[model samples]
Every structure is written in C-alpha cells, then in structure tokens.
Target: MHIESDQEGYRSCVNNSTSCQAYITYQALQDDTLQPVGLCFRLSVEQLAEALQIAQYLSVALDLFTSMDCELSSVTYIVGLKACRGLASEKESDKGLYLEKGITIHKGVKEHGFKTDIVVATNFLEMYSNCSSMHHAREVFESMFSQDAVAWNTLILGYVENGDYAVAMDLFSIMDCEPNCVTYLAALKACGGLASEPESEKQHHLQKGIGIHKKLQEGGFGSDIVVAITLVDMYGECGSMQNARDVFDRMIQCNAVTWTSLILGYVGNGQCSEAMDLFARMDCE
Candidate 1:
C-alpha cells in the first residue's frame, strides 16, 4: 500500500525531529478516524495548554512580551487565570494568593483603563466567582455602570452557586427588564431547589415557570435542545412528568438528552412501567 503525501510528510517530520521549513500540517482524528479542518482547528487551540507547558519548560513567560503594546489576548488572559487558579489551590501555602493574582490582574486592567471592556470585565467576574470570592464578584459587578443581560446572568449564577438563592431571586426580580433564556434557566433551577412547598406556594412558582416557558417559546428558545432538556430535567425533578413528557414529545429531533430525561421523569415519578417502555423505545431507535 502507498502512503499519501501528507502522511509521508508527517512521518518524515516525526522521524527527523528537526526544525521544519515546510508548512507542516496536523489534525485531530475523530472516533471514526477521519480528520476535518474544523476538528483540526479545535485540536490546535486545545494544544495551547500543552504549548504553555512547553514554554514553561523553556523558562519562558509566555505572557511577557517585549513589544510596546505588551497586550495579552483574551484567550491568553483566561489561560493565565486558569493556571493561577490550578496552582493556587494545590499549593496550600499559597492560600489567598490566587485571588490576589486575580485582583492584581483586574487592578492592572483598571489602572490601564480597559475597565469598561465587557470581555475583560466578564473575565474578572468569572475569576472572582470561581475563586469563591463572592465579595470580589459583587465589587466587579457593581463597578460596571451599565450591564447587559450577560453580566446580570453571571452575577445571578454566582449567587445561586454560592448558596444564596434568595439573593439570586431578589436580584433576578429587580432587574429592569425581563430575563433572557439563560436567566430563566438559572432561576428555574434555583426555584426547583425548594425542598417542601405549600400547595399554594407551589402553584405560584409553577405558574411563574409556565410564564417563563411561554416567553422562551416566544423568543424562539423553546426549540433549543439544551433549553428543552433543561426544562424536562427541571419538571421531572419537580414531580411534573406530564410537563416533561409534553416538552419531549414536542421536540422535532430527540437525542440522548430527550430520551434520558423521559426515562428519568418516569423513574422519578414512580412510573416504573413508563420508564421501562421509554427505555425499550430508545433501544429500538
């Protein structure tokens, strides 16, 4: 069997292990063992982590550039944040240091005055939120004179994650305008966390949820597989299998999520026979 030129070139590079003058190509292979440009680009970007490691080995600070601009790209800043967070946790002696680094970078950005840049601001909020520094997240949020839905959603999510659902709901309610799909999803999850509810209270939240669902459908988010799956999961957890099933049945294309949610809904609601029937149908599909 004869090898193709690209394969031959790859093999030659691997054998020689020398600096290459030719424009070398690399790719990511999927499970079926085919390669595509889309996959290759994804793989290349993923390799940045490994490249960072190699740069470390060479005693190079990848973030340090001698150029006057000296600006790091957003991706590089995020990667730096990840690296700092990863180390700041494992090295117990470095306690308070990761958050310090995050604060420092954020301060530098502010002193340099990219404070108004939404991308940088969002990254700062994410770093603080992930570091379990809700105070810092709040400061960052409050510093912004104006916020789009993304900023509001992030803070609401942070509050929910930090186990302050009341604050999350309060912030959610007082927002100047209606919540977007992501906001609705987060709010629904928080509402579903209610352990025990009086029948009247349950009806209130359920009605609110139904209203959100209607808004979602009107906003063209109803057909989103992720939103649909989340609705199914939420309704199932809340003992609303009928609602879950309605969502599932409405899906134009059912994937693993739709099938799993249906099975889960029946199992959760103690409808074992229905769960088993769905499983059988899924297997046939």
Candidate 2:
C-alpha cells in the first residue's frame, strides 16, 4: 500500500509540478516569509534530480506524452524545453543528450503543424539562446512566418549575449518590426561589445555605434536617462570623449549613472583632471 501511494505521489508530482512552482512563486511575491519556501523547492528539485538521475525519466515521460498526445500545446513544449535547458547546464556529458531532446521537440513542433505559433517559436528561440545555441536560435527565428517586436528583440539580445555583436547589428538593421526600448538597449550593448574589438576593427564599430546613436535620437529616445547614459558610456569606451560630452551636455536630466559614465570615460582616456572636475560637479549636484 505504501509503495502504491508513493507511485501515485510521483505521478501527481510530475503532473502538477508546474502549478506547484507557480503557487510557490506567487507565495514568495505576496509574503516575504514565503521566499525561503520557493528557494527550498527549487534547490530540492536540483538535488533530487541529481540523486535519482531524473533527467532520464523526464526524457522518457516526454517521449511518451508526445506520442500519446496528437497535438502538444505550446506551454507543454516550453516547460519541457526549460527542463532540458536546466539539465543541459548541469553536466557536460548530459549536455548533448538534453540538447538533442530539445531539438527533437523543435522538429516535432514543426512536423505537427505548430510552426506558426509565435509564443512557441519565441520560447523555442529563448531555450536555444539560453543553452548557448545561437545557430539553432537563429534558425528558429528565421523560420518564423511572422515576427513580432518581442521575437526580434529576443534574437537580437540573444546574439548580443552570445558575443555575436556583428550579427546582432545586422539583425537589428533588417528588423521589419518597430524597435522597442529593449531593442535599442540591446543594440547599444552590441556597440559596446564592438568597441572592445581589436584596433583594426575599432573604427568600424565606432562608426556603427555612431549610426545607432543617431537612430536613438531620431526615435526620441534621446531624453531617456538610461539611453543617454548608455550613449555616454559607448562613446567613452570607443575613445570618443568629445561625442560623449556632446551627448551629456544635451541631456535635460543627469542622474548619478550619467555622471559616472562621463567621469569613467574621461578617466579611461587618461584625462584625470577632467574626470575630477566632473566628479566635483556630480558631488555638488
């Protein structure tokens, strides 16, 4: 009887884990006392999975579920993919197996005629991105029949996170959807990444950064405090103190981040005196 009850509990746990996780998350948000409850649950999952090699069981269950269900929902795939991603990161030897499982699910999604589902595609793209599989992410993105701003932003940020700044810039240029604030911020980060390249590539990236800066202004993001601060930092990192200062001077508001970016830019360029002056002004403010 105990064994049968335990088996029932395992089945229930597998079926209801997602809801349990959601409830735990809500509890944590609503009450500070519940924060440790969520953390403990997450930590226990990892520890239990490690002890019992649960990834193997999960893979088998996923295969069975997919085979039995004529049409798998996007949410199901997303949850499965997330689990694969977590397992992939846990051990080098397990990475290939989990990645292959994710790829299988991707193929299944297409074969089962859910390819046009944007949420599913985005979740698939994000799963690949999180797993450091940019090539797969790009493939999923490019295959989308219609892309949204969020989808475009996801791929753009994915490239930036993967250190493929050049591709991120190219993707940004061809994006059919209107770029959002997150898009602009990710592009700025790509420019910053470019500035860190070798001397031979430095000027080329600086020019690209300047073009993005112009776009930011035209898009009316010039006054956004975060955007303005990013511009200062980008120009400073590229050794363009004059342009950085030009942006700083135009800002209607200057926060601590804005002041710090300029000061660091001056310091980076070996202009300690100018940095000191800016620090004094920042202190006064």
Candidate 3:
C-alpha cells in the first residue's frame, strides 16, 4: 500500500510537470522497467530516451516494446530509428548490436503499418545509410511510395559519405526530383572526390564539376556563399585558375574560405606573384 501511494504520488507529479514526465519516462526506459502502458506513452518514452542520449538503452527498449505487438506511431519509428543511428556511431563493437536492433525496428515499422509515411521512410533511409548499410538504405528508398528531393539528397549524400562518388553521381543523374541546395552541395562533394581519383578519371570529374556549376548558376544558387566557395575550390582543383578567379571576383561577399580558395588556386597554378597580390588585397579588405 505504501508503494502504491508512492506510485500514485509520482504519477500525479508526472502529470503536473512536463519535465518530470520526461524524466520518469527516461528513467523507466533506462532501467528497463517501462511497462506496456500504451503506444503513445511508449513512444513518449522512446523520445525521452532520444533526448537523454541513451541510445543503446533506447534500442533495447524499442526491441522490448515492439515484441509485444504494441501499436506503433510514425513518431515512434522515426525516434527509434534515430536512436539506432546514434548507437551505430558509437564504438565498432556496438555496431552489430545496434544494426540488428535497427533492422528489427525497420521490420516492426512495416508490420505496425508506417511504411507509407514519406518522412519516416526518409529517416529510415538516412539511418541505414549512416550505419553503413547501403543495401538497407536502398531498400528503404525503393520501398517508399513517394520520393522527394530530401529523400534523394539523403541517399546521394549517404553514397558520398561512403566514398562511392560514382554511385552517388549515378543516383543524382537518375533522380526524378529537382535538386535542392543540399543536393547541389552533395553533388559538388562527389565532384571533389572524383577529381582526386586516378588520371583517367580526372578530366571527367572536372567536366562534371563545371556542369554542376553551370546548373547552380542557372538554378539561382550562384550567389550562395558555400556554393560559390565550392565552385572556386572545384575550379582550383581542376587547374582552372582563371575560372576560379572569375568566381572569386563575382562573389558579392567573400569569407575566409573564399579568400583561401582563390589564393591556393593561384599558388597551385605556380603563379606565386598573383597569389601574393590576392593576399594583399584580402588583407586590405
């Protein structure tokens, strides 16, 4: 009876304070004491686990919760997947465990009927990609009923991060959705990576980088500072110092990275005098 009173009092406290509720949920999940209250409350617990950064415990809680065949929400799946991603970023030994949990949660997402939610699907794509599970990521991407620029960008960036620049470029070319700023950014990164490949691959990537630059200008991203800096870096890397200078001169505003890129471009082209002149101008500004 005393324990029951304490439980009631605690419930009352949780009811009155949002932070207290999150704390209790977090503690319950952490201790593996969370009962099958309902799907909504279980999801709240999962969210609290995410907020508390106890990703390993979150994965365990998710496994325990979903095994009971409890109803699942899109929020539950997304948060759980995010927690798995967090765990995957930890030590190598934990990757197998987290990856297994993540796969189970992926299956649960389908069984619990969230397969059609585009946002959830996109997050699944990102989670799998970050975990170095490209096969699973591609599976999620292909399973989605609808694809948006965000989804495409996620997969493209995932490929880029995995050092599969060629595959990333291939995906970009086949994307039905229009590329956004992030898409362009990832494509530029892939271009940079491609430029560093063997001699046979160098000219091809440079041309691709130039093509992407033209597309950025046409798409009205010409003035984006990051994009402009990327263009300068790309041209510099490709040994096109004149193109790099052209981009640097057209910038409405130049940051440190922009200045460094052009300076290095001149130096890389063996024009030390021009590089010094540019450095002097930068110092004056």
Candidate 4:
C-alpha cells in the first residue's frame, strides 16, 4: 500500500499509534504487524514513540526508548529527551528518575553523533531545564551548534523557572536574536521575581519591566491576553499598582485571571478599598 508515500496513511498511523499502550505496541512489534502497516515512519520504533508523544504517553515512550527499541535514530533521542522532560513535570516523588534518564539519553545522543543536531540538542536543553538542572542546561546551551531565539528562550526560561531571576534578565539582555512571546514571558517572570529584593533592586527591575511593557506595546503584543495578564502581574509584584491598572485598562478583553491580577495588585500594596472596589467592578463586568 506504500504507506510511507501516502500522507493519509501516515496520519492514520500516528493517530493509531498515539492510542497504543506500551504493551500493545510491544506486542505489535512481536507480531510483526509493523511490517505491513508500513506507516509508522516506515516501520521505525522511533516514529512510534513520536506518535506516543502526541498522546502524552511519556513513560511508555521512554520504556520503548530505553529497552525494546533496538534501532536508535536521532528522532529516538529527541523522543527520549522530550519524554524525560514530560516526566519531570509530572511527579515530584520521581525527581531523581527524570534527571537520571535525561542524562542517560544525552550521553547516548552524544555517542551516536547527534549532540550537535539542533532539535536533539534543544530537547536536551529543555529536559535539563525542566529537571531544574540549570548547570547542565547552561552547558547544553553553550555547546549547541547554533543558538536561535528558541534556544535562547529555553535557557532564559530555565533560569526563571529556577528562580535565578537576575541571570534570566541578563540573558534576555544579551540574546543574539530578536525575542519572541516566550522570551518576553520569561523576562516578565524574572522582573516579578525581583519583588522580594531590596527597594533599590526592586525599583531597578520595575523600570526594566516598564521598558519591556513599552516594547510589547510597540511590538503589538501589549493587548495579547497572556502577555497583558503577565504584565499586570509583573507590575503588581513591583508594587506599581497604578501601572498594573494601566495595563489592565489597555487589554481588549479581560478574563478572571486578568481581573484578579489587578485586584491583587491593589491588595498587595495595602490599598484594601481599591481592591474591594475593583472586585465589585469585576463582578459587574
């Protein structure tokens, strides 16, 4: 049926495989059904794991990558890394397991000469980041063959996620490429993270946050709901209740999260009456 050449067949294979349990795929492998279906990326185990990723069967994909899969392609490494990242985000109880598997997959990727491949490398960086292994994540970023905005965002996000706010903002300043939404999001998060610093430090980041807000408005992202909400939150964290209200007023649409951000800004700054008034207004709206 030339499944490899048929686009519809390719899609069907992915859909079917995404629904597959590890045992089902394993049994299918044992039964040689893949030889005929021919659409799971030309019958490759790596492709099967890619399909499993769509269903977020992360552990199942890892099991195949670690054990049953004999042929390890670059895609297999990426799948393994992504699965490791997914697992890291799942259960706090298994933190060691996620980092260990991620490190192992990285070693295999290097051994197989895929360490320089951009996709594989970026996934490795993300896996390390999600595990909060910023030291390893920074090493991966530095070793990448090329650093695009996506890679830059991943590293910055890793620092922000790890509460290294100063380092995150420093990266934002020096990224070689233009920033994207993810970069801006990470930057705002860093600015927000500075709220607990001394007054001078907090005010310094507040100005930077304001600068970023202006850039977002110029870049036509000021009205982006997620960005606007985050901007509001950043201002709130910086004790700039009026700035938070300004961003709130500029948003084209306001969700509950958006409304709550501004209200919390007032409450956090000790403006109890303003918080109550804003909450009442939100209910009316």
Candidate whose TM-score is highest: 4
- Candidate 3 lDDT for residue 272: 98
Candidate 3 local lDDT, 68-128, one digit each (tens): 4456677777777777777677645676777787888888888878888999898888778
Evaluate model 2: give its lDDT.
Answer: 0.72
Output the TM-score of candidate 4.
Answer: 0.87
RMSD score of candidate 1 (Å):
10.5
A best-first ranking of the candidates according to their TM-score comes to 4, 3, 1, 2
- Arranged by lDDT with the best first, the candidates are 4, 3, 2, 1
Q: Which ten residues in a row have the lowest lDDT in candidate 4?
A: 33-42
Model 2 RMSD in Å is: 9.2
Per-residue CA lDDT of model 2 for 1-285, tens digit only, reads 122334444334433434344334233323534222233333323333322224344443333333332344555566567667656655557666777778988887878777788988888877787677889998998898899999999999989888998899999999998888789888888988888777677677779888888888788888898888888888887888999999999999888888999999999889999999999988998
Candidate 4 local Cα displacement, residue 77, angstroms: 0.9
- For model 1 the TM-score comes to 0.66
Runs in model 2 lying further than 4 Å from the true structure: 1-72, 79-101, 104-108
Compared with the true structure, the alpha-carbon lDDT of candidate 1 equals: 0.64
Q: How accurate is candidate 4 locally (lDDT)?
A: 0.80
Query: Which pairs of residues have clashing backbones in candidate 1?
Result: none
What is the C-alpha local distance difference test score of each model?
Answer: 0.64, 0.72, 0.75, 0.80
